[model samples]
Target chain A: MNFKEALESGKFTVTAEVGPPKGTDITEMLHHIDLLKGKIDAANVTDNQSAVMRINSLSVCKIAMDKGLEPILQMTCRDRNRIGLQSDLLGASILGVHNVLCMTGDHTSAGDHKEAKTVYDIESVQLLNVVNNLNSGKDMMGNELKGPTSFYQGAVVTPEANPVEPQLMKFEKKVNAGANFFQTQAIYDIDKFKGFMDFARKFDVKVLAGFVVLKSAGMANFLNKFVPGITVPQELIDELKEAGKEKALDAGMNICARQIKQLKDEKICDGVHIMAIGMEDKVPEIMERAGLL
Target chain B: MIITKKKDPNNILETVKKYDKFFLIGCSECASLCGTGNEEALQEMTDFLESNGKKVTGQLVPKTGCQTLGTKIELKKDKEACADADAVIVMSCGAGTQSATEIFKDKPVYPSNDSLFLGNMTRFQMFDERCSLCGECVIGKTAGICPLTNCPKGLLVGPCGGMSDGKCEVSPDVPCAWVRIYERQKSLDNLDEMKEVLEPKDWSAGQKPGNLSTRSEKKEEKK
Candidate 1:
């Protein structure tokens, strides 16, 4: 079944993130897609993840579709103006890629090309409205479209953001803007996530808890120090440190699988979105350990 | 007020290398307060120019450099010196620089300062932007805090995912605009307004080369 159908079925829907390569060589990316076949309800093609330039998400989404995998076309407002964004949405619709995840992307300064000009002509909430307009056979300006797109719209949230109230307000705005589902920033603390879910349950949209598989103790420390809105609990870091270098990867997978299991068992959220970063090959193993396979 | 910063001295010298004589103009308003275009700044530029083997014909720090016609009239006393100069250097904002361009149509006009933004002076010579002139104001709904001018991402509804510890991810020193708005609204017991999803901003209202004429409005009123 497609991602929309999977979500509506009330089953635990799983999605994985796949970043396009910087160059044209899609050999490893295709291999990763092949590995994830039938393993996930959908594969999210990141649009220049972290503002670093990469192969466009649209082409990769089309490629994923050709390989019989549902693709979630991630669109960001950092690089494209409103005109470019709307045109790309139309292009994605024509290519049979329906799922679009709206994001107010990481600023261009965070990327490799720090000198690049940013174009935040429209932000995530407005982008969601644009998607809803397109789905309704109209444009953002209220102009009619000859053909309409039926998009499965998605957006992102930060459950662990320090100032959680503003984030919650934006989350509700996204819901009002017609966001069907939300895949949040990587969440490490389950109890804190439970608190966020208690508030999120008021909305009709589905919430997909984000999980980034921890690779090592140092990685957890780095996440805590550098990555915003994500705080790695000290105990989890200690668990990884005790596992040592050789067994850390396994220990990390175990932690991720355990978290996923708890999230599923407690029904804290509708589903989980796994962001393996560069470790796509290990996703099936992680899912198997979580009893998802 | 419009905030401005001076161009590098070396870069300015290089730009005017081909010209032997220059007539400098300064603004006594914002540019003077910014230390980019004032009597002291103009004297410093004159010294720098003469030491670099260039000649300064004349200089003026007008009451308002952007008042094109008034500046043109004020510059009439230096017409001889201006006519002898090869180029005109403006040490003010872009508007002030364009005034020189209009007055000296035959000579090349150069700006020695870059107009940064419309902002307020938080302290002596320290400026912070507070408005973007988006042509539509939503500060009433946001508790008088303008997110469009403050937020780096200009997120309409609320903060983006990058807000951490009430600070913006882009710059840790800068507090998140939405967080400030939320706090202010909460204090005023107007948090309910925060829940209202603001419609998409009409960008056309702030479209490029924005033009207006108060005289036309007055004519319409008279009619």
Candidate 2:
């Protein structure tokens, strides 16, 4: 089923992400698409994910479509201006790429190209509005379009944000801006994620808990230090450390599966969006362990 | 009020080296408080220009440098000296510099101070940005603090996860604006309003070269 249909059907949908490579070689990317096609309900194609230059998310979405997998195109405001964004939305609609994930993305400094000029002409909230406007058959300037898009608009939220008030405030804005669903930042603490969902449930939008599998202890520490809004608790880090060098990956997968299973059992959210950066092959295992299969 | 900082003496000198005689305009408002266009500052600049072998034909510390009509009326007394000057140097903000440019269309008008921001003077000569003039005010919702000015990212809804130790992620010394707002709102027992998520800003309202008439110039379209 398509992402919107799956979300509306409320069967605990599963979504994953696929980051397009920096160069023209799509062999490994295609393999990833094939691996994730049937395992997850929909796969998101990231647009130069860490502000790094890569194959366009639209192009990767097209590849995923060719592989018979539904693709959610992740668009960032850090790179494109309003005009570029509008044109890309129209293009995506024409190409039959329906799902969109709007974000104010990682800053340009986090990417490979440090000196690139960042264009935040409009951030995530405004971008969501633009998508809503387009879906309504009207442009940002209030001009009517000959054809309107039927995009399943989505946005990102950080449940574990230190000052959670602002994030909650923005979450409401996203709902007001016509977000159909939310795929959150990587979630480690389920109770905090549930707290975020308590607020989210007030709105008529789906919330998908983000699950990034912890490969090792060092990876968890790195995310805690560098990634904003993401906190890998000391206990989880300690657990991974105790798992020993050889079994850390397996322990990490188990932790991810447990969180997904808890989220599913508790009905805390509509579903989970698995983000296995370079390890797409292991997603089916995660889904199976979580009893999603 | 508009905040401004004076340009470097060497840079101003280099810019006006070709002109020997000049008229200096200073503002008695924000620029004066900022110490860029006060009477003492004008006198100091005049002495420096004279010491550097340049002529200060006349100088006027106008009540408000940005009020073009009032400045034009005030400059009537110094018309002869202003006419004799090769250029005009405005020691106020960019708006004041543009006023000089508007008044003296022929003479090259230059700004001696760089316009910083519209801010609150926290103390004597210490200015802190309080508003970004986004053309829409949400202070009532944000507990009288502007996220646009205080937050480095200017996030309408934030304190992005990057914040740590109650400080902003972008700038360590800066307290997270949203955090400050939350505290204030909590103290005031107004946390209920915090639930209201601010919608996307109507950016067209703050379009560049913003112009408006406070009252009617033409009749209203509808009653």
Candidate 3:
């Protein structure tokens, strides 16, 4: 389905994400998917979350699909050159994984292999254009492909981005380059999210405000400090801080539900990506409180 | 502001499948300026290589590659350009060819383009690599202001508020970057100019040690 139709399904399309383990273990990963299968519309398999190499995102995504779930394949351009990138795009298509998100992978410095060489012949915007080209039966050099790709191309956004104009400019560029839909960084501040939506609405594209489930205020602070372009406000940190050890989990879920409700009630975005991280079980509860159930 | 361009060696020493007698040739013009194939450089390199054992030959060809074709630019093709030198290490930029390969395409070719984006030459032999284009440009939020450009003295952190009487606190000659930014922003019709504060940039990626460029939200790792 075109991303727009899937996004504006109006029933408030709920999606969840699962980051695979850095090691070769699938039991927890499978459990995560099994828990979210019928609870949400689709599950996204993150590619090497934060660029530290993990179990292949595509392989894990295929596993999720095998469990009778629609997996939004997240492909980053970090580890692949142009040849590998296109091959992977075709690889995803051949695997029947039609919903794919394109991203320029995390920097090598942030990953496990700090000294690894980076083959940067293609980055994200170019990656989006590359997929657009592939779908048009052409490669980066404008060479024709064997067949066209009908993959539903998606990109990302950071609502709380610093100097947000560049993000907006990139958002526009991605759309022009054929990004049909976008998933944003988690939203903790309503004003910031609204501002982002205001910017997004100006462009003709589908947006899913991404929700990264915070385990605690510490996690929020970590992202704000270390993670570039992602800032969870102090109020959310305070809310997390108020939750006692035993009840912290409960408070986190409550916060997630509250945010989800606001996102749905305000129609802040076309959809929301529930990134439960390792805690996939709480997703359904968050959804239930948000009234998606 | 390190402005320079690649100077591909003319006789690239391209694909020296096999070799022995090697002349470390040098170009006196662009290569010299770029600190690569100059006579002093080639001489030093040739001396070091000779000290290591192999028979050596060296020549300093000036204006060797001002044109695209032929040896017309060849000021003088001594024996070093022909016989003694097994392969021509055409120290000129990619434009430098034939002189080395004329006698030896069968030899190798190497590049000296050190290709770099052209930049304004600030001084006689020095240049400032202008417009770093940090991805996180505070230009918009800062009222069409560029803390980078306006500050003649190169300060990423905003100018000191205590700039003694409008001049840069850093120096007397340098105008406060903030003062310039304020003026530019005011003209841009953004009254909100100077209202928004600039965030200290994420020096992690932009830091030379990281070697990361200002990319979109998606940071590309060099594969």
DockQ (CA atoms), all models: 0.75, 0.26, 0.04
Q: Tens-digit lDDT track for model 3 on A161-254? A: 5445434545666787788888877777777788778878888787887777778887888877565556678887888888866677778788
lDDT accuracy of residue A125 in candidate 1: 89
Answer with 2 or 3, whichever has the higher TM-score. Answer: 2
lDDT by residue (tens digit), candidate 1, A1-293? 78999998888989998889999899999999999989989999999999999999999999999998899999999999988999999999999999999999999879999899888888998899999999999998889999999999999999999878888888988999999999999999999999999999999999999999999999999999889899999999999999999999999999999999999998899899999999999999999999999
True C-alpha contacts between chains kept, each model in order: 0.82, 0.34, 0.00
Model 1: runs farther than 4 Å from truth?
B216-223
| Rank list by lDDT | 1, 2, 3
lDDT of 1 by residue, B1-223 (tens): 8899999999999988899999999999999999999999999999999999999999999989999999999999999999999999999999999989999999999999999999899999999999999999988888898988899878778898888899988998999999999999999999999998777678889888888876787799898
Off by over 4 Å in 3: A1-7, A20-25, A48-58, A76-95, A104-153, A170-180, A201-206, A216-218, A239-254, A278-293, B1-22, B46-58, B65-77, B80-223
Q: Is candidate 1 or candidate 2 better by TM-score?
A: 1
The docking category that best describes candidate 1 is medium
* Order of the predicted models by DockQ, top scorer first: 1, 2, 3
Question: Residue A171 lDDT in model 3?
Answer: 66
lDDT of each: 0.93, 0.88, 0.66
CAPRI accuracy category, model 3: incorrect
